[model samples]
Target: MAGAGEPGREGSGQEPLLVFRTMMRRLRAECPWKREQTHRSLSRYLLEEAHETLEAVDALAAAEDAGDPRRRDAAASHLREELGDLLLQVYFHAAVAEEHGDFDLDDVASGLAEKMVRRNPHVFGPDPVAHDDATSVDDAWQRIKAEERPRAALLDGVPATLPALLLADKALDRLARAGRPVEDLDPDDLGDRLLGLVAEARAAGADPEQALRDAVRRRV
Candidate 1:
């Protein structure tokens, strides 16, 4: 095992990802806390790290908007740290699985790369797809996904545990894609009204979840 600062075995080039995976494996073996963690146990940390990364993204955007070079640099560093923390969750889960003879980080990464190549026919396939714009590209991607999971329900892969606003946004998007868009709005009912707002946000090309978070932040 290589020490933190010492790059081990000259002439054997070290990739950061492989090094990180090795570090995670060692942590799982030697660290008491990491040793005890299961996939179920690490779920909360994963979620928390994801949200922290989001916050770091917002901060970086704000710093850029403010035109502060120093602030932007600091924000970028914070975002990178947050991203690394989130990635730790991934490697942690992979290490846990590797221990049980399930899967490892390489398996997870390879599957993702394969999925991206499979989905983006315009970029990687033998017969390239012609997409005029981002919307068309997204449409093509969704179509490929649908074909891959034939006979799946509209909400089959949509997690019910998503934030209410985001859940409504995805549900509405699915309905619109299926040509069963929710045209009827009920202002009197809170849920329907909120869904309507989410639809409006979607049309305006905004993230309702982040918009609401910003609004609440301004209020407090």
Candidate 2:
């Protein structure tokens, strides 16, 4: 099995991604469900696939810890299938856009490649990284991204669809990084207070969800 991000040999000069796109094209033309799918309609499956991929990750970790190659392989296979489904969602959306005379998959790939180079200054730019310092590298990444995509507000770009704890944590982190204080919003209910506590945890550099889970587990 090829590890993640490892390049594979081209199949007789046929680019694997292009081949996959061609397969997607055929499916769009022949498959009734695929033909009927729009970007909006496929959103639910995209979310489901992402969650399933996360589940596969957890299973793979457990399999590896158990030192069972067979179980690990099974977990890897499940992950691959889920990832393929997710990839299909990308291709499906791009195909729909292409049919409407908008941008296609090539544009998507090209833009991502350009962004990768533009963002990774330590690797692709003049400021090369001499030693691999993961922490410092991440700081550079966030700095570069901040400059590339400036937002008017600190938490303006945070995704609303993210898990509530994650969203709260991210928003709080952004506010803290920007030297902005989190105003003590009046809690209307227990949920709001929990969210506020999550933000407080982020401010204090703690994991609120893990802390809560640990506390609950002690009672069990």
Candidate 3:
């Protein structure tokens, strides 16, 4: 795998991975507060940073819609700051890993490199797959993944902590992956079900999240 600051440049001469490492090292050495941070303490910051990044993306879209170049630059600046905040979480995690002699940022990066190569056999192997045949690559990726975690169930990988809408999407996706028959839902019936739920929520003056939580609590 390529090191962060290797020769032969792209875009800028600086490598982003190296830059991240340098920032991490500086934070570790120069900042007392940063040095004292733990994974638990940094969790909220990571979530906040991710939301900020999404907000910046939204701002960029709004700016483009309004034809405002200045807003574009402001949005870009916000994006950079948000990304830095996210990187800080990585740095904090790496520091914790280093303390425990588990693994550091480098190990994380190298593992990613290995996974990428393993997933994309077309790029790394002699029998490169045809570019037009995306299904072939997808099949290969799934087969390789199954081999890697032989004991894991089909639905084991999706996180239970995701938002309800996202979790629903993931659940549906996993079902599709397991070759479940996709019988078409009647749009009129689906609309009626959704509208009834909305009406019930409004009648009860209920927060949808709380209602969903309650439903989930009962089911689980």
Task: Tell me, by lDDT, which candidate is best.
Answer: 1
Pairs in clash, predicted candidate 3: none
Number of the candidate with higher lDDT, 1 or 2: 1
Per-residue accuracy of model 2 over 61-128 as CA lDDT, tens digit each: 76887899999999999989888888888998999888888999999999999999987877888877
Q: Stretches of candidate 2 above 4 Å error?
A: 1-13, 129-132, 181-220
Report how far off residue 161 is in candidate 2 (Å). 2.3
Residue pairs of candidate 1 with colliding backbone atoms: none
lDDT of 1 by residue, 1-220 (tens): 7555443642147787777777677778888999999999999999999999999998898799889999999999999999999989989999999899998777998999999999998999999978889999999889999998874688989999999999998899899999998977888999889999999999998999989987886687
Candidate 3: C-alpha lDDT: 0.70
What's the TM-score of each model vs. the native?
A: 0.91, 0.77, 0.67
Give the lowest summed-lDDT range of ten residues in model 2. Answer: 3-12
> What's the C-alpha lDDT at position 109 in model 2?
93
The lDDT of each candidate is: 0.89, 0.78, 0.70
Ranking by lDDT: 1, 2, 3
